[model samples]
Target: MRLRAITGFFFVIVMLGSVLLGNVVFTLFYLALSVFCLHEFNGLVKQGTADPNLYTGLLNGIFVFLAFAAQSYFPSKFLLFLLPVLLGSIFIQELYKKSEHPFNNIAYCFLGLLFTITPFTFFHGMAFISGSFNFHIPLSFLLMLWANDTGAYVVGSQLGRVKLFPRHSPKKTWEGFIGGILITAGVAVILSRYYTEYDWKQWVSVGILISTFGTMGDLIESMFKRSINVKDSGGILPGHGGLLDRFDGLLLAAPIVYAYLYFITNA
Candidate 1:
């Protein structure tokens, strides 16, 4: 417990610092984040599964992030360039390798990119959600996510009785889920005072979405780990398990939240 707490403290510090610093730090941090996540996914898949195109996938990750990070400067057409290149390189490479399961290789490479890189690209785009670089949206989202996690941990440990999903994650409970949603929405309401662009209701809705999908994200990752017969994604963060463990919530939530915010604001 002591090691976990200590690790968590510094983890929170780095997370806060990266966002509060500026767009550059935020961009650089998440870009590196996306790359590491892809690398980790490749490693996980390679344990007995097919080998993804590590270098090719990494290159795709880097370019994908750079294109999205500079959304204003880079033409959307540049993103189109990546699709054919990714498919062509993977397909062509597999043709020569004479692997036993080339289709699986091709599939997992695509999955790795979709699983990690794509979602993170959506996540970092939150900075520019308001037609400019504003930290409020991303920062607020992070706070809600953290609040849900903390609330769930406390409530589940104290009063959890019903299993949320015993197969994928036995520790989670209905009580924890409800507690997390309530706490996250409450935090969002409080956040409305500072980020006045969105009222309490909108933020609360966003909070609910994050908690709901974030839990799903956790379950999905748990499913992935269970299928692969692993306890944690990696030991990169000590007590935190891995980057995937830390941001699993962001995986499914980012894309949904991004679409939600965009539709509401633009509509």
Candidate 2:
């Protein structure tokens, strides 16, 4: 457990630094991490009851990385490239041997892509969001997420009684989830005072989304692990299970907050 915390802390530092560096450094780091995570996720599928398709996973990872990078760098070209590539991949994969679960395999492959790579585009988007308020968006999002996770663990351990989803994730409780939200909101309120650019309302909204959707994100990953009959996603992070285990909440929270800000401002 100590080792896990140390390793996780270091990982967090490196990741946060990469984001703070905010340029090609973070982009490359993010891409590499995404590939590693996708590989780890696909490894779980392969190690279990299903026959693992290595090439499929690799291709899917590439496409997901390309899609995200293109979306961040070239929005107009992203869709133009994304649709045709998706159709082509499906068509090519379909032409191969028709297994009993051909579509099932392909679907899972794509689902892995979407779940792993799509949310990360939000981070890329954050790097480019202009305004005096934009500089702190990523840090604020990350800090709120960290607060939520820490609060849930501490509070839930002390006072968690009512189960949130006993079957899906036995340890998660309603009390813990609410505790996480309150703690995260507290942090948000404190930080909002310092942000002279974004209104307090915007920060509060981000806080709410981070805590609420963050909990949902944690549950979603739990559902996936439950479906696969596993405790942790993998043994990569010593005690934390896998990359997905670490980033699950961030994955869900980032996109939601990004979209909220985007639509609110753009619309």
Candidate 3:
């Protein structure tokens, strides 16, 4: 428990510091994080004989993230075109390997990109919403996510009785779920006052989305691990398990929240 708390404290500092610094640091931080997560995902899935092309997949994932980040600086959309080529390279590279399940390898590699890379790419977009570096959106998103996780753990430990999803995650409970939403909503309200980019209602909506879908994302990752019969995604973090275990909620929430913010801002 002490080790987990120590790791979490430093993790929050690094994440928040990157955002506060500027767009470049934020983009680079998540870019590196995306690569590590892709590597971890590929490694974990490989335990089942899917044998994803980690090199090609990492290259593709890095390219995808760079393309997304480039949208902020470059006027021409030329770089985005490279994404398809990068993705295609994965399939092309698979032919040389004598793996029995070539298609399965390709599929898991694609899944690694979709499940890990794409969401972090979307998160990079949040920093440039107003044609400038705005840390509030992404920072607020992280805060609400943390609130939900913390609230769920505290409330669930004390009052949880009924299981939320016994198959994927047995420790989760309906009571904790509700507590998380309520706590996130409260935090969203407070954030709205300072980060006036969005009104209170929109922030609350984001909180709801994070608490709901973020929990789902955690469960989904848990299901992935359960399918493979592994304990943690990796031992990268001292007590947080792995990058994937720590950021699983962000994986699904980032894209959804990005879509919501994009539509509202553009509309």
Taking the tens digit of each residue's C-alpha lDDT, what string does model 2 give over 7-99?
A: 889888986887677567767777777777777777777665554355666666666666656555556564546656664575467557556
- The residue pairs found clashing in candidate 3 are none
Lowest-sum lDDT 10-residue window in model 2: 126-135
Clashes (backbone N, CA, C under 3 Å), per candidate, total 0, 0, 0
Report the C-alpha lDDT of model 1 over 8-60, residue by residue, as the tens digit.
99999999988899888899999999899989988998986788778887887
- Residues 1-267 of candidate 3: C-alpha lDDT, one tens digit per residue: 999889989999998998889878898999999999999999999898799887888888888888888888785679888778878988899889998889999999999999999999888888787788899988998999999999999999999999999999999999999999999999999999999998999999999999999999999999999999998999989978999999999999999999998999998
Reference-based lDDT, residue 198, model 3: 87
Q: Which order, best to worst by TM-score?
A: 3, 1, 2
lDDT, model 1, position 140:
90
Best by TM-score: 3
Worst 10 residues of 1 by lDDT: 72-81
lDDT for each candidate structure:
0.88, 0.76, 0.92
Candidate 3 regions with alpha-carbon error over 4 angstroms: none
Candidate 3: count of backbone clashes, pairs at least 3 residues apart or interchain? 0
